[model samples]
Target: MYIITDQLKENGFSVNRLDQIIKRNNNKRQFNTLEYFCIYIIMENIGLIVENTSYNITAGNIVFLGPQKSIEFGKAKGQDTFIISFSSSFYERSIKDSLFLNSQLFFNYNSDIFIAPFSNIEEMRVVFMDRMENFRKKDKSLYLSAAHNAIERLILDAFLHIPTEEVKKDIKFDYLYCVNKFKVVLQRDYKTAKKVSHYAGELNVTPRKLTEMTEYVLGKSAKHVIIEKLISESKKMLSYTNYTISQIAFELGFSDEGNFTNFFKKHTQKNPSEMR
Candidate 1:
């Protein structure tokens, strides 16, 4: 395990071996809500649940996760795996890098989990090893920059191997940028601003234009995006917290418990209590 953090702890990065992480957690499967972007390299078969979806990952597989996602690990005894986690502030050196991070390559709102097989497992290992070496450096002068470069290399390598068709070529970068900004704003104001018009007002675009942008880039309506985010947050709270259904509703800015129940059941086909 190698952990490097800034003084404020807002910008930090870490690399840890799978076995060590499990051992540190009393050898139990771990459930985590990531606060940073993460890359998981699996050298053995494993099961993973990302935001309520299960995936079977085998050797040579890599998983990418954006921030605020819930992930549960399955057993992988004697398996070799490495987890690299870094905050956005730690990784973003320029506006281009920030936009790249928000791109579909990493933070795709349409997908819960992104997995791809490494074309060259040894080469991937070398990248992680280099990052670890940078963390081990004592001089500490160029370590942060070197680590950033290593992460950039890893992302670009993954981009190359990910199927070209998976990339959204039809959507221009401007639309993608607007859609990404909408997502960021949606995440920040989901509780208070549940309506599409509110988001459009915040983004300085008309509601119809927002919907057009979201549809162009994500193939989903802006309203659907907002509701999806609300549902996701609702599920997270129900699954991970002891809050009652009514409290959860209030927290999510619902007018009343009954309204929330109707909305939840309409979308999920289950009551909030049933989900809990």
Candidate 2:
């Protein structure tokens, strides 16, 4: 796939066509967990596995994937699928932007992937094409900002068109809002602050109320959410990095390696080294 923007940078945006990526890997199914968020626009029927769940995607469909979700793409030859990806640091330049990214439109704690149909496929394609052109201009003044605006437009458009039925009608909006905010805070502080009370303090709510809100919206307790985040990050590190178990434990804010090991094995039924 042709990358419209540089991929070597720490924080950046990129646009890629899926055909070349699949072909480059010998047309075999590819599995990955990206460190950044992604929006996939499908121009043909294809299969995708997100978080181990299979989905058959058709033409005119758009898929959103948050960071650290495992994804497997099925083979598709000559399909006009395109992906737009960006890092949190690249997109969340302000509090408003951060909250927007954490909104249900992009980040849903109960689900790692969100799929919707794009009724105006041609118009969406035009916007993506223009964005690719803008990102190609590395020397242009405010080129990155232009790219940001384009992506924001795409996200906002998706937000406006998301199917109402996808959301649970029984849940109250306040609980949904609180859970969304809790997710944002949990993601930001999971490395240093793993306690539910700490997260409640951050959101200016009682720990009991926070747990109730999380249960109401995500069908899990607030503490469960924190543990899930920890396990997810731990697996990524073990599978992708060369860090020793002790080092990883320290990095994740555990008091000691033994405690980390016990915790990991208790939850995942495997040692960190075995996972690696």
Candidate 3:
């Protein structure tokens, strides 16, 4: 597994081999880091446990581990694998364009990694592995920026092939409706009210109804959904954009910047700049 404690390390990153820590399952051995992201291609035989999440990475598929994430994995069963790490800056200049976002072939809304099927992965991996090899070889002409861009393109191609999960027709309507509606209102006013009652009033529903609806749709309370979306959006802005604290607060519609800072600090422990 790869972990980056700092956003931009010298020559780009620092990685440590995590051997038996995960097999033992002790909670104390956590690898903490600053804002960063990593990608891994694992054989089906190997496995990983990230914090409380357990997953297996089959060949031709990609998995992502983001900053401040602690994880553990096993050795490969047969074929070789890959692990690439980079700062967010790598993404902005390479994969952050609107074309990449709309490329559908390499993007998804609900999940971080977009998995491609074997046929597509096979075709893509040839070109991808070539670039990977060039970076690994550390040729004198190779630059850190070029290496990051190649890896980013590979990630996007993998995502493009992953289709959105078909929403089950039999799923509960109360849940689906609430989640969609909540997203609509949330994007409009996440920073202003961010209270259950505020959203409930807009929907003309009672707080109890709002809670029940949210639980049905998202397995969470209305308040939790609001907090999660706001906090997540706040972090995305704080990390990806160069906006100042007050400008961010004002844009998000906070009455004042102090309220926004307090709200963010309450959830994340670190203030905005500290997060950066």
Candidate 4:
């Protein structure tokens, strides 16, 4: 469900009644969303298709989504969920905590985090219910502070529940810190920054070092990552928009239509037209 923008402006965040939202908007086979970081506490089975990955959500499950991450609902009925959504600005203003948000849970590339049946489930449920009641009361001072605290508590609980191995995994490849940051850089500038050296320069690493870190972390070289991102975007535009190949090519920073066609065919082994 989408965050109601007006409520967010007034309260720095918003909580959606998840069952109501699904009832109102679940007519479609897929509901693709591209806004807000979302946290879902599930009271029953709820399935989700996020990007290309599928998640089976069940009772006592907590699902976290990053901003601009696309997701579609999977078919399951009789589910009750509490969905908390907030903007990056609001979250920062309320808690001043980006560390956990940037950890494996929230904003990492190609990853989403979910927790199942934590020790503080009842505590979290109480906080969520209390926050909802206060929110319905429309007492700004009361609800806003409570809502912020409730969300912060949920985040802390999530951090506490994270597995020891996950922490060790992150520490093992300390270069992963650089790799994740490099991913952010690539995501922001992939269209214009085509060369590995360009991304390496932005991340203040040598091209070879960048490739090595990326391969170590992602199992692909830096150049493959950049090219794959471009190809993925191209596929999206080709499938979803009416833009011609030439238009898509120019829009994606290729010098010419022929160059774009060659790249697409080289990667996909099919012309863009054939794919479309």
- Please give the CA lDDT of all the candidate structures: 0.74, 0.74, 0.57, 0.70
Q: What is the lDDT of residue 31 in candidate 3?
A: 42
lDDT-best of 3 and 4: 4
Off by over 4 Å in 2: 1-5, 8-11, 23-28, 138-142, 162-220, 224-276
Once fitted onto the true fold, the runs of candidate 3 whose alpha carbons sit more than 4 angstroms away are 1-8, 13-34, 75-79, 94-141, 162-222, 226-276
Best-fitting candidate, measured by TM-score?
1
State the lDDT of candidate 3 residue by residue for 1-276, as single tens digits. Answer: 222334236555322223332223352334432354565554354565553345666665666554445555545532344455655454545324323323333222353334453445555444445654566578523555566566656656565554545324345544554555555566556767778898888888898898887776567888888888777778777876789999989877787889989989998898888878
Tens digit of per-residue lDDT, candidate 4, span 1-276: 443457866655777656555665645434433445678787767777665456787777777766555566665553356778876566665223555555566654445445545555566566787657866698777787777677777777777766765553343234665676676666567778899999899888899999998887677999998988888889878887789999999989999999999999999999999977
Q: In candidate 2, residue 54 scores what lDDT?
A: 69
Model 2, position 88, has a per-residue lDDT of: 75
Clashing residue pairs, backbone N/CA/C < 3 A, model 4: none
Error of 3 at 198 (Å): 19
lDDT of predicted model 1: 0.74
How do the residues 28-129 of candidate 2 rate in per-residue lDDT, one tens digit apiece? Answer: 555453556788989888888775456889998888877655677876763578877787788887755765566665676556677767777777677776
